[model samples]
Target: MDSPNTLAVRIEPMTVDDLPQVLEIERVAFPSPWSARAYEYELRYNDMAHYFVAWLDAWALRHPANDGVIGWLRRWVRPAPTVGAPLMVGYVGYWLMAGEAHVSTIAVRPEHRGHSYGELLLAHTLQDAARHGAHVATLEVRVSNTAAQQLYLKYGFDKVGMRKAYYSDNDEDALIMTTPPLNSGQYQEKLRRLQIALTMQLNTQMGRKLSLVSRTGA
Candidate 1:
């Protein structure tokens, strides 16, 4: 429940228009973040890269009590309208080459952390990657980030190797994590169950339904 924080989120392929908000979260999420140009190249020219963004649905976040008769009356008694586009709460990107997909980056906005939004992004993006033909998935996380390691492990990733001084900002070694062949029956069952659990968890906090959605990369 992440401290009873109600949330509703959508996952979609990152469009060029999402960069502004993406960068806003990126700047504070890492010690040495990728520059705008870097993201631009990935979205615009990198054919192997597939990226997705998670939006916090403003309409979904509105109080459920503001509905039907109560909502209709509230409009006249105390009018408050849900407006504007859903905001980008986080993003995840990965590069797929041959049969391998490498999780490049993932982050959530500071205020939106601890709600499993990062896990949502990771799970959805990884599913997308598999759908697009990723046989295996891999990622590198800071050795000190036990939290991230735990999450990866929960998703069937295991520590396979390491790269010394992987983070330029801190010279911290990175633990290389990789998942089993994504098409394995065991993995399929695991992913299916986890996704179902995630949906139930999300709806529990959302106060409403927020279904998963994705799009093909350009």
Candidate 2:
């Protein structure tokens, strides 16, 4: 059952058209964001890269701003050209190589942070990876990010090793985490249980319910 406030959210392949909003999120989410050129290369040339964007369908019309500068602008631009479409909220990127899926980056908008959106993105990525013939999924996180580490642990990722001074900006160590074979029954069952729990959490905390839909077939 979906909550009344639930929004239609979908994850789709990242296209060049999505870079504008994706860049905005990238700038705010990371201390060292990837350059637009880098993203362009991945989208255009890197066959191994699979990036996705999460969109809140018809979000603008459903929650219109009737007051403030944004409202005034909306009035000024009467008969707004764009309406009734999904607005990109967050993104996830991964590279599939040699039977492994490496999660390069994932982030949600700052204002949209506390709603279990990140978990949703991660779950989608892992499921997508499994469907695409990946045996394992892995990622690296700043050692100091315990909250994120905890979330990864909850998703069946384990700290297998550490990288020395992996972060360029602060020269911080990164914790290397990897999941067991995603195609295995054990891992799939674990993911299924987590997905069920996540659905409950998002429904309760965000006033909105959502579900995962895999493009490549999960």
Candidate 3:
């Protein structure tokens, strides 16, 4: 198994082409996975929805052991970008309404759950929301999901309310969480610092071998 240290993280807009992998992840990550039709609707028709996938291209990180002249050339010459599919380890989705960004879903493959990748996804979502002029962010999580609640709290979200029997599948109550104004200088500065810390964490974990690319254009 490749270490989390070997991960090359890339976040891009989710596409129909990515559905198979994303569906697999969705199944493994959640007990009640979203249907393919629903994902298709979001990707193809929803205008206010923004979705992203976290890709781990370990091949690049695993192939840096060559030496000598060929190695020198390889080091200096960037590999031609290949049109290959990526390994989808996680995904997130949110809906932008008025000036609020509402997180609809977030998940990571079971094998990839413990390495702070969820936080990375949430961070990117918040950052994207801020970029799009969103004043605040919100989400609803299962009342029993303490791990997720902790992550939200760490990112400045607070428990605002609850929806009784919000989950149709099990009639579970949902805890609503909301963050303070994201456009404020204090919040932005906090995000900036967290982004820097994530960069350093990834660098230290990979021994400086990987780059974290989280682009919002998609």
Candidate 4:
């Protein structure tokens, strides 16, 4: 059985009120965090934007005095219902343009990186995109980000192309990837397999942590 602490994390949509918290996390997570004004614009001006936060009960479960966001994602929606809430433990963001879904960004807090939260967020985002009638999903990742590339490939996304100097930080090129057509049985099956693998991985990590805590207490 999972411990109460492991089950307490929640994935919720980003609201106007969440910007302060989101920006804080962004500052800690990204060297070039988006400005507060940028976040404000996203919340107020962009009708197609959907943001989310991942809330992890880090302190309450162990330390008792520390709590903070564990992950976040900002997605763009095109004429679809916005999903927002309990502040997610990770987030997936994308844009819909010209009948294709273009993933903008997906980030997990450093502490939460190995726990499958990214996978959860991606799954949720992909499901939502399908629900919103996207036929194809696309995204670009830094060439150096092999971990992210593997994750995308696991979901049936293929290396379709590349862009020169796509990321500004180090002028890193980006590898453009695209998923098979949405609602296709092959892609859905791959997604299902990936989800299952992610679930197992998360559960294993949670179990290990819980066991270590129990042993140390004993």
| lDDT, candidate 3, 41-139, per-residue tens | 998999899999999774532434434677667646643224343567789999999999999999887745666778889999999999998999999
Reference-based lDDT, each prediction: 0.81, 0.82, 0.82, 0.64
Summing lDDT over every window of 10 consecutive residues in candidate 3, give the lowest-scoring window: 78-87
Would you estimate the TM-scores of all the predictions? Answer: 0.84, 0.84, 0.82, 0.75
Please give the distance, in angstroms, between residue 162's alpha carbon in candidate 3 and its true position after superposition. Answer: 0.7
User: Rank order by TM-score, top first?
Assistant: 2, 1, 3, 4
- C-alpha RMSD in Å of predicted model 2 compared with the true structure: 4.5
Q: State residue 1's C-alpha deviation in candidate 3, in Å.
A: 22
lDDT of 2 at 204: 63
Tens digits of lDDT, candidate 1, 34-150: 888999998899999999998875564355655689678866764443564577879999999889999999999775677688998888877888888899999999999999999
Give the 10-residue window scoring lowest on summed lDDT in candidate 4: 209-218
What is the C-alpha RMSD, rounded to one decimal, of candidate 1? Answer: 6.8
Deviation of model 4 at 18, angstroms: 1.7
Candidate 4 wrong stretches, greater than 4 Å = 1-6, 58-89, 208-218
- Two-way lDDT contest, 2 vs 4, winner: 2
Overall local distance difference test of candidate 3: 0.82
lDDT of 2: 0.82
In angstroms, give how far residue 58 of model 4 lies from its true place. 5.4
Model 2 CA deviation exceeding 4 Å by range = 1-5, 59-85, 209-214
